[model samples]
Target: MPTDISRLVHNVNEQGFTALEKTGLRGQQDQGLVSTLISRDLSGSDDLCVSWGRILPGQHHLCHHHPDASEFYVVISGAPLVHLGDTDYRAKPGDGIYIPRGTTHGITNDGDEDVNLVVGVSKPADWQFVADE
Candidate 1:
């Protein structure tokens, strides 16, 4: 995917920072999940695709899985109910959650505050997204 400059602010050009506003790279998406891509394989140099994401209060997203890539979710603030494989776990702030390849995963935010999070997929360009049932 080409990098659209419209979403990028001067911070992208001034600093060596990549734009974090790109969205919609993964397919196991909850329509309500707000995602901002931090980096991706678009330039052929990115081995991972990373994003800053948010699950608003009271939102629950159905699970999805990556066929060929490992994934990770880091809780920046607010705990969300994290679903990995067939189990559910309560996540806390500053926790880095790891999901192996082909594991079904999703997240829910039932707290009063929004769940701020960071999500990453290794080998984004080579992985297949399966919207798990």
Candidate 2:
């Protein structure tokens, strides 16, 4: 059986995935940063907003926070300084950092190599608060 992928696959290259710069997500065109959106719009997944993010040496994503969503940054390459509020982590390849909703976070690459990360954020909950019966 063949499953049609006309809408499911947005970009396919010889490597089988779209290059980060071609996706046009934030940080892609910004100097020293590259990002590719991989969730929600790409997969129709309701639970995540994920992307591939890269930071070149001496570059950083300025500290910021979102009130309604938590986030995770999993290191794919290069050890970089990851900021989670008042704490800082020198995360290496394969390391994962979780940032709670409303907590400030960002990442900086100080080394000579680029820092690659698989970044994910939680989606808005479909459930609503209910008063006790």
In model 1, what is the error at residue 66, expressed in angstroms? 0.7
| Model 2 vs. true fold: TM | 0.70
Q: Total backbone clashes of model 2? A: 0
- lDDT score, candidate 1, position 16: 34
lDDT of 1 by residue, 33-133 (tens): 54435444333336777666767787766677878899898999998999888799999998999999989987888889988777788874656766775
- For model 2, residues 1-101, the per-residue Cα lDDT tens digits are 99877535543232133332221234333224434354565567688766667787987666667677888888999999987788888999999888887
Instruction: Give every collision pair in model 2.
Output: none
Tell me the spans in candidate 1 whose CA falls farther than 4 Å from its real position. Answer: 1-29, 41-44
Instruction: Quote the lDDT for 22 in model 2.
Output: 22
